[model samples]
Target: MQIKQRHIEVFDAIMAAGSISRAATQLNLSQPAVSIALANLEKFIGFKLFQRDRGFFAPTREALLLQDEMAQGLLVLERITQRVTEIRAGSTGRVRIATNGAMAINFLPSLIAAYQHKHSDVNIDILVRSSRQIADWVSTKQIDIGLIDTPVPVAGLDAKFFNLECVCVMHRDDPISAQKSIAPPDLAGRSVVAITGQHMVDRQLDTLLSAADVTVEKHISSYYFAIARNIIASGGGVAIIDPTNGKADLNDGVVWRPFSPKIYHELALIRGSNQELGKAPAGLYNLIDRSLQSLIGIGNAGDSNE
Candidate 1:
């Protein structure tokens, strides 16, 4: 007959408790049941596991040889069961995410840290790429989630859009920083730092400046809003950047003010179409949604034409 799990369990319990009656109590089985299981295990293995003297049970040489391995195997089994339970409860898993550089550098680290604080067992992998690359990864199911600049360059992916007003950031000591809002005319003749390569923010700012009959000297151009903020902090020039990056850190000698005519930096949270996110990814996804809503609400409350 094949060795059964009951045989191994009974053997382990007797070895640990050192008596048939005690092992029976530990396993909640009758003494006769424990004796029968141990007998069956010995017969199957062709060796004596225990030597009995009066009420005492002593481990045989063969039993001693198997004891350490059996204990280790049992520990491994227990750990596997625990990990399975954690998986079922949504407390442990790996989540893969991809996003554009702006959020990757300026925003997501703190959010990820807060998430890990509660679900420490959940492993997370974050990748920074361009918006188009992030969209492609989400569409192909290569990532659990993607945060990207809109419009989403790929189709067939589920996307949630957030429209955030861009803000003007300048050195804290700059006179414009004292204003609650900055209009295009306020930027006229001022040295401006802007995103490179005719980005959406640059186009929007250009249109507004033209409409206001004002022109600002473009002093510098950068690929990322966070980099532009660094330039602004160093007293390079004022910049209109995404509110997320603008308000990321205020103690860096930079202050953000709501910009008039309300240029918006659009972003989209994306995932594969028809794909269901696992528990850990879904938790993070919901957290990001709530946080972004809170940020947008704060920005709207502060926006004014005055």
Candidate 2:
């Protein structure tokens, strides 16, 4: 038998709140309207779904039995409505993503281009922040996906392996490049520029340096590694950056060399623990992985040249 959607809503509200007055307040409907909806629903179902006693409402055994089925049906309806909204908004539905500033600048452009080519209708909104902040956003469900490096473990988030890049950074025509390889001691007592955020790159740098008993004279700190790279190029200070970002800007007179002791950065895609990744998010995440792999290949191929 066909029943109005409002009837189901009223029934669900009463079950959830366990009182007609509370359900009316929760649903933002007048108490009289709630009573009318309940009476109408009882007529439709031809059974007492709830029992009223002492000015309170309580669900009957049949209502409790039907709760799960009704909730599932409502969820399906909500999802259908969301899909329709996306279509009307000129989207197949967009996945909101946030990434570390490094990835947003160094890796996201290429990944986005490739993803758009494959799924032109799918929209993505990307925000740039530190890895730590991105991880928090994922945990809180503020965004659908996050891309960042590890060591900033966000509780209740699922992480998928993305790609790895060398942690070595470069300076343009610096005397250090002439050396076949530089030792950890070579970076000692030098001025360095670094990124700062809740998920700062400084964590890895500090770990490596502390292990080696080295200290950096932090000259400047910013969220954008690109900004730090610019400072390094202008002879302000050396910036510790990823291979992808620094390599692309080589024309600006920055030459990258491997840091001694072999530091490497790992990238991962993160989401809330209970979040169900749909077709678009999964597809876009895969596309990003491929793009990063390609970038790594190109970086590896040119390792000999540097």
Candidate 3:
């Protein structure tokens, strides 16, 4: 027997309304259309659905048995439709992000705020660690995205590189601040706060100083940029770091200026090579790029070219 949704709908409507005329009105159908639908439904199921007397209809035992299943089926369809609508509206999701301490301290928070304002239903998890750790996290699928500066390629991760400018940070009243723009030669004989570890930024800066044959007093060395910045803030020595980290230095009694022979660190977004960014993360990637560009004071608000 052949059957369709119209057959069930007309059958249910007739059972509920009790008369062909009332069922037609309820279904926005003519009386003859309702009667024909009832006849077809009875034919498809090979059973009589109603007992009629004086143009009134009543459900048979078979229809009473079918009503519960029909009701459940319609309920399931309603839920599926609602859920699809919710997905289209971007109403629910979760994303995890891991990044180096530098990006976390000076950047991501503000960007996350703006992102949350727009996608209020999305849950975000932010973790701050060493760049190497963040890369591993991305590769293992422990996190959805990462931002870091690395000179070497990480296996199982895709990178989008940006030429992020580095600068020399020092105490505001220090004599190097008077140089307008510092150089490898200008740093000679100065007490310097050097960033330690195998970080690419530190390595690049070290190579540049070596090429210029510049040597410093090497006052204090640390892995975290904030520690180095703190030393510089206390009038200890000059520290070469990113401008974003030093942008807040002035308030700390220190300031930063560009280096003469601009050395750049490659800052990139790292993600699992096998994973693709979804709607929320893609929006977040743009926000991150835009925030980085803004912090460096180099690009317009719309220059977020992932």
Candidate 4:
């Protein structure tokens, strides 16, 4: 006769409980069933596994020798089950991302960290690139996903869009921070961090200043919003930047306020339309989208207060 799995469980339970009645209770079986299983197990193994002494069940020398192996086997089974659960939850995959340096700085990092906490087995990689190159990056498979501040219309890539407005990024103690929304003339003669890379946003700001007849006497030109933000934090000057990028370094004593005439930053999440996003990338995509929605709500609330 063969000793089956039920026989081993019955033996283990009896050893653990020290009696047929308690083993039955633990296994949700009747005392008679537990006794029968123990009897069958002993008969199959050709040995007496337990001994009755003064109305209590005691494990014999042979039973004691097998107990540790039984526990280890059960532990291995439990681990296998846990690994299966993690796989089903998509917690063991990899997701590679490319995005503008601004997004890499703040909200995206927070979002990625929170996701990774839940999915410790998942691997994540981030590549920082200019907004202009994000489209090509995704299309060429340089990254599984691309997050950009401006739309990129590359073939074989699809864009899911989200909107946010530019803000006046400044030191919290700056006199301009007192106002909820900064006016064009308020920045006149103030040192300003300017983007002179010929980006459309820079051109738009130039036109706005030109139309307002305002001049920023001191201008520091930079290609990266992150660099511009750092300048502002270091007491160089205030900057016009997207709220997402502007608020990325709140701990640096920088605050973002609404601009008088809003400048909308067109942001898009681009992925290869032909390729199916794997579990990790898809989950991350949904998370970033939800975060952007929340930010838009906060921006609207701020506008109401202004």
Best by lDDT: 1
The TM-score of predicted model 4 comes to: 0.69
Number of the top TM-score candidate: 1
Show where candidate 2 strays beyond 4 Å: 1-91, 130-133, 161-165, 197-216, 292-306
Q: Of the pair 1 and 3, which is ahead by lDDT? A: 1
Q: Which candidate, 1 or 2, would have the higher lDDT against the true structure?
A: 1
Candidate 1: minimum summed lDDT over ten consecutive residues — where? 297-306
User: Model 4 — which ten-residue stretch has the worst lDDT?
Assistant: 297-306
Question: Looking at candidate 1, what is the lDDT of residue 88?
Answer: 75
RMSD in angstroms, candidate 2?
14.0
In terms of lDDT, the poorest run of 10 residues in model 2 is 297-306
**Candidate 3 all-Cα RMSD:** 6.2
Per-residue lDDT for 31 in model 4? 91
Residues 1-306 of candidate 2: C-alpha lDDT, one tens digit per residue: 476677778888988898889999999999999999889878888899988899778788999998998887777778888888755544476778888777777678777777777667798898987778989888988888888877556789888764444444556467776766555577788887767753334666778789889887885787676777778778866766666776765567766765555545567778789777777777776676677677667644334234
Pairs that clash in candidate 4: none
After superposing candidate 1, which stretches have Cα over 4 Å from the reference? 1-7, 43-46, 52-55, 303-306
Among residues 3 or more apart in sequence or in different chains, the pairs in candidate 1 whose N, CA or C atoms overlap within 3 Å are: none
lDDT of each: 0.87, 0.73, 0.75, 0.79
Give lDDT tens digits, candidate 1, residues 1-306: 986667778879988899999999999999999999888888889989999989778999999999887777777777888999887777789999988887887678889999988888999999999888888888888889999888899998998888887889888889887788889999989999989889899999999999999989996899999999999989998999987788775578888888889998888988899999998899889888888887778766564222
How displaced is residue 264 in candidate 2, in Å?
2.8
* Global Cα lDDT for candidate 1: 0.87
Q: Scored by Cα lDDT, where does model 3 land?
A: 0.75
lDDT of 3 by residue, 176-288 (tens): 67666778898888887777765666667678889989876875787767777888888788887765666552377877777767766668788889687776676787778
Q: Estimate each model's TM-score.
A: 0.90, 0.60, 0.69, 0.69
